[model samples]
Target chain A: MGTVAIYSLFIINKSGGLIYYKDYGSAGRMDTNDSLRLASLWHSMHAISQQLSPTTGCTGIDLLQAHNFDLHCFQSLTGTKFFVVCETGAQNMEILLKTIYELYTEFVLKNPFYEMEMPIRCELFDLNLAQVIQKDRVALLGR
Target chain B: MIGVGKAKQYANVLDKPLGRGRQEVSLSAFAFLFSEVVQYNQTQVDNIAELERRLEDAGYAVGARVLELLCHREKGNRRETRLLGILSFIHSTVWKVLFGKVADSLEKGTEHEDEYMISEKELLVNRFISVPKDMGAFNCGAFVAGIVRGVLDNAGFPAVVTAHFVPIEGQQRPRTTILIKFAEEVIHREARLG
Candidate 1:
């Protein structure tokens, strides 16, 4: 079995604030400010795309492809957005995002100290995220 | 009480560096837990108000905990300073975290300056519940109200939160509204501060 090359992850709040961000594989280092700007820009683009949809309630962009990587976005009902950057053909991106969101709900939201619409720095969330990513990697490697 | 060894292990878990997330609870498990809570309160209470109060008391603890956790998550340990800020936090953040969606709407009481209401078309907790007619004006939403009250009281807002069932035309599910009435001191303080 081949490996799943997951590149990075970003979480944006409703008002287009970058709440959480992480890089898994080296997708090249982006400056913090640049990454934040990218998140907000993507958020606006998502809204614009939704507006362009003929349906009244259009779910925004779910997938975007580039030359080398693919971006998969999962938007929660409350408008919190999760974007995962993966290798061009990474499978089960939706499943991965769902698990990530679940981890987020359990650890970050449940933590008594986490503030809303802010950068997620919860220890438990980070640990579980790593575990999930590693587990997926191992599964992909057929170990 | 837990044994010393077990307590120590728990402490160790807490001491571990951040980002180690806890396991997620299934909705069915939560539903079962909530049902048991209601059943337990039903057996213990003589009146609907008493039952609701017990449920509210149970939810109060959850609310208090959620309030602290959500505050930490959103503001990086800083809490909401104003009444409107905290209300919006509860209306948007708390509802979203708890129900996987934000409440339908938030409205101020036209008759009362110190009152506000957060309304949900269908409350997650009440989804599977069918209130018996004999229960007489009882709503399971009291648990949520208790939670809201717990959050506000802990945040130094000191408000009375109550849950009411408002039936909307052509809707099968009765809408749940959590009404908040701020304490006199809170309003006075907010006025002076603002």
Candidate 2:
């Protein structure tokens, strides 16, 4: 079994705009402007990785590993990319990302007042995301 | 660049967690919210068309979003490119996802070649909605029709979707028939491409 502890979550829209950004723990600190810049930078990097592939078309990157943290990316059919930053060697990352995508669809997209491609500020979405993060508290604290 | 510790204050805001739950919301909450949406629009619109349009507009965003999510959830994330394929996807998969079941029936228009119909015996959105006679020819099913239109339009099939109340024999409530009239260009393209 693999241990997983998520640190932060980022959602980039199809046009490389940062739509939603949330931090789960005190893992890292970056200002709003810096985060936005990093989001777009990562978005372009993802696009470049897909293009640089030897194959004619690439499905983009799904996961990235680093010394202290790991990044798992899930791209929806509509081109929205959800990035989850978890501890190294996180297990069941796929399931967690899938649940997060589902939550975004349900709480954010399904919200009547939410405008498309806007910075997600839905109260329900935040609530559900917090719940998901809380459920993994033990794993997160173990890190 | 400043010390990383200074930036820590920004992350401290979310230190405490909030409410809980996944996708499912309370039915009573949705009922109240939907009722308010209808009531708020009813006060603003002067005619049935405008009211229905408002409701449809509300559902349109939902449909557009659902189409993408549903496509993502499907195996291999394959999208429906054909007319019949998308219609079936919306009728079966989309309906099941949104309403918890497939629609009652999907019928091709006998009179018009460019039309299709999805009939529902009783729509969930309209379950609690009781239309007053004074309002005249108002059907909440227009919201669902709007959603269908949203899904279709987002999938590159531009069409006009309208809801009609067809009374079934011995049924207390009228069945909703969502009539979809495809654009002439869509029909032409389908014929040429198919």
Candidate 3:
């Protein structure tokens, strides 16, 4: 079987809590606990990178490229983190992350039941996420 | 103020950011959130005044941050010092951004030296709010009143702000009046400046 281009997408709250996780690929799906660990560890590393940077006004790491897969992250001004893991050469992921942030503001933040900084449980958000993921797939297939 | 446009079926919505600027940090979200705040506070308070006060306190924080942002972006960080100047700023500049239109009126109280009124046909916070039987005369505009007070106080023009409902004879809904009564010091300073 061929390899899946995208692995997963994650949404993290400001304080490094893993608020959301979704897996798209059949390859190497992580247990929930492991994904949670990955989010907090990545959060610490992102913060440390800011502290370690010699230049002023560091915004922390945005992309991590491994041998086979790449991770792209976008942090909103309000400090929520949205990241996606994809094949190393994936395109338009930054725009995709921004789209996710936009949907988040509309469906999640606006939802009255959504307590601030809590896990995302809104079905509207999940429905929109699935649509975004499908669009990502269609875009990649035409490439 | 939020324009709910048709959801254009772009081949990929992720292709670009939504048109112009409506997608960026929605203000409509705040409307729903504010309603939730009112509902939550309703369970906690017994009297209408107390409930409105709680909602106002919540709006105070929002107003303080809004002042900081508007001053930085809209006024080039220049703070207003005079009474009428600041009142006009809130009436025109701040009102436009916050509620999508300039306030209906900014008038001096005929009977009072320091009292001023900024009236709106319907405040966004109170537009959809239906006061309960027990919440009679509550005026969710109290949140907006707090917001006005926060902006004036932060701008160094301290004032006592409150919300009132004045029903028009023909209109089904009463108008919202944000009453701004400047403190003695502010009035004195205005007089001295004059």
Candidate 4:
């Protein structure tokens, strides 16, 4: 349970450029170069997925799993990415992503200070996100 | 029998269609729709003050129509005459008509005769809002201010309604209080009548 932490969140523009990024929890979790590289790679992957998609409009990518960790990327119709990184066996990943999406819609996106395609710095959003992740940890511990 | 027939005929002559009967709306629907309206306006507006002004204007429109409908729905016998009388009427009757409940408290300014206030522990539009830090300039209560303005305008009491978040002790969510300042003409008229 303690092993899970949201390393960062990123928003990718439609053309596959890194628009925003924020790192939470432990300092130096991901280096500057790594963060930028990951964002660019994810942006390109997201665009490719959209182009290859038979259906019209943008959608989300399936959970990407590797040996060390897992990357969960959810995209909005407008091509916004709500990226979450967690342990391989982390439960309720989908629910966590949905809740973050809801928070972005209500607090960040709706907030006037949040410029389009800019990084999010909403205190309320940060607090809510922290609370949600903590709750998930507690639930996992109880189980 | 003759008198009853005459009353019925008079009612028929006076009755006029002002649109459909009152429609029941879900509180959730109003809350969500209003939240969207605030969000939509927040995007276009430049600052907190302008956003609030736009919200007040929006509420003013609704208030005008709501006040008229409320007066029309009354039995037509107990119309308000005095300034305070109409102010109370606006607080209770008009508030209930729009928000489904009267405001928590209504008070007249102690120092100024023309100033009044309506305090609600939790204003409806702000119930779910947690203003993002970047958008520190946004406040959902502007919509409520607009509604108050509408009620005042429709009632022929031109006034400015400003919604503020004044946290009170033991309150969880931010408390919204609407300050209404009446025009000098209203005070003058009240004084003359007295």
Candidate 5:
């Protein structure tokens, strides 16, 4: 019925360039240049976080947030980022982000068609995600 | 590993709760680990069939251990002698021990006496799996095949388990049928024994 208020999603490469982007909700609300620049900046911050990582062989950044929107970034242990963007006030975004990461790890990364650093194109991931987001949206809208 | 003495002591301390004797674990952990296994195999093999083989091997290993434990629980009772008997034992005891449920259906091959089929509406590993278009060559069913191989091997019946996504005349979720063909020697021995 309804959907989760996930504004957009992005995937940043290890080097911090924009690799993938998708807007699930109504678009044109945020400036395109601003989002891209933010992605770039977060990429840098993620790199810094990686440097500060106590564990050796640790990969990309995770769950970086700004004032207007929250950014959740999951880097594979190999340094690929799976990013999710949601409204700043969204509830339990972290759990949803973790669930998405789990799905990616299970469906996308495990998929032989999914090459490293390539964009995800697993049908199951998309379908299950849509269902989860839709449920969240309905709950949010109802509230 | 916990020492036998410690294990027994702990078991004694928690007598009432431990009386049930079985432990429940989070299925999520198993799913995550299984996902990694699929990914690791995907990296090594080029084609779907090979990947399934790898999964089957993995399951075979687990099955061997499961069979030993099940028998041990039975105080090291001898394995089943007949094909139907062994299969029935696997469907009920082995399946319940591993997957927590028996397979959906167990049918004899109409054409071949030595061949049998186990159909599962929802396989444990494939329950949450959605194959990406790029990896169209691979099937999640291989892991299930591996599980079957494991169960059979432990029961002293060596067989080849192949996973297939066969669409029946009317089915919603893809039906995964594991085709089990016992080794020629096994059937030959059965005939000789008779």
Candidate 6:
């Protein structure tokens, strides 16, 4: 998928629960159980990485590079994590994740019916996420 | 600017100047915060009326603080004593500082002596929300209505404030009208002052 780069996006809440997951036409899509397990695994790995650091104030893993793809992780102040798996050495992943965080805050957190620290069900959030990821991440910065 | 690349210290938070009673918040940021306010209130109530009342109560807190803040900073410590004077203050000064623009229209009711209306084409809080078909006759503007009520009550002009959607024939989105019906004492005092 040359035109569409990102494989999938997963959002983990403060307590390491999978709150949101979206796959943008990946070759192999994981089941919901697999997705939840992946989220919990990432959360623990992030914590363990911080402890493994020699010096103090070490934040968890920011990027994990595999032969096939790259995984980028962004942690908010409140411990919520947003990770995007994309094509190898994908550009502007940081910017993309940050914008997604903003979208999460606006559409999901702001929605009156939405329960906090739960699975995201807002239509606006889904629509906005699709638009941002499908297009070039750099282009969305003007907003 | 004095201490670059250093943490600034304050003796007391209250000792700082009020800073011209104007602040800027990005529209997106404001929308998110407003949504949180709505959502928090939603979890606490069951019925629509209760939800609206809770939202209004939240707005009232904001309005009361805003009145106190503006009265000190903008009006040189002189609070508005007249009904028209206070309405103008809210319509212009308070609206400008909080919402970045004045309300669209402020008019006295045609039939009622004590009633007044402040209309906004698209209230900032209502911008992103599209009320569901099932949740009929519910408007997020109730929070703003509470704000108006808060301001009026704090100013010693106790009134009943409510928000309604007034449909305009050609417009796609109906306008929000904040209706204020003054207490009997306010009307009597106004007549005495006149």
User: How much of the real interface does each model capture, measured as fnat?
Assistant: 0.00, 0.00, 0.09, 0.21, 0.39, 0.27
Off by more than 4 A, model 4: A3-5, A17-22, A31-36, A47-61, A109-115, A121-124, B1-55, B74-78, B82-85, B108-114, B126-140, B168-173, B183-194
DockQ, cand. 1: 0.01
**Poorest 10 consecutive residues of model 1 chain A by lDDT?**
A106-115
* Residue B27 C-alpha lDDT in model 5: 76
Q: Mind giving the per-residue lDDT tens digits that candidate 5 earns over B1-194?
A: 34576554445553532132455566778776787787788789887777877888887788777766676564355777788888887778777777889888999889998899988887777766777655554567787678778878767788988887777767455778888999998899889888
Report the C-alpha lDDT of model 6 over B51-106, residue by residue, as the tens digit. 99999999999999999989999998899999999999999998988888999999
Largest DockQ belongs to which candidate?
5
lDDT (tens digit, per residue) of candidate 4 on B1-194? 33565534435645744444555687556656776677687787787778777777787787777766777776353456677878788788877766679889999879887788889887766654666655554567777777777867666677877877787887444678888898898778788999
lDDT of each: 0.84, 0.82, 0.82, 0.71, 0.73, 0.87
Per-residue lDDT of model 3, residues A36-126, tens digit only: 9999999999999999999999999999999988999999998889999988888889999999998888777655446788887765577
lDDT of 5 by residue, A1-143 (tens): 22546888776666666655667874565566766787788878777876999999766455656777777766655666667777776777767766767766666655544566655566667767777777777878887
Better of 2 and 6 by TM-score: 6
Where is the poorest 10-residue window by lDDT in model 2 chain A? Answer: A106-115
Clashes of 5: 4
C-alpha positional error of residue B132 in candidate 2 after TM-score superposition, expressed in Å: 0.7
lDDT of 1 at B170: 89
Which of the numbered candidates is closest to the native, going by highest TM-score?
4
Question: Candidate 1, residues B72-98: lDDT per residue as tens digits?
Answer: 766788899899999999988888778
Predicted structure 4, TM vs. truth: 0.70
Off by over 4 Å in 5: A1-7, A17-20, A25-117, B1-47, B109-114, B127-129, B153-158, B167-173, B183-194
CAPRI classification of candidate 5: acceptable
Badly placed stretches (over 4 Å) of model 1 are A1-143, B1-17, B20-24
CAPRI tier for the interface of model 3? incorrect
**Model 6: fnat (fraction of native contacts):** 0.27
User: What DockQ does each prediction reach against the true complex?
Assistant: 0.01, 0.01, 0.05, 0.17, 0.25, 0.19
List TM-score per model, in order.
Answer: 0.53, 0.51, 0.51, 0.70, 0.64, 0.61
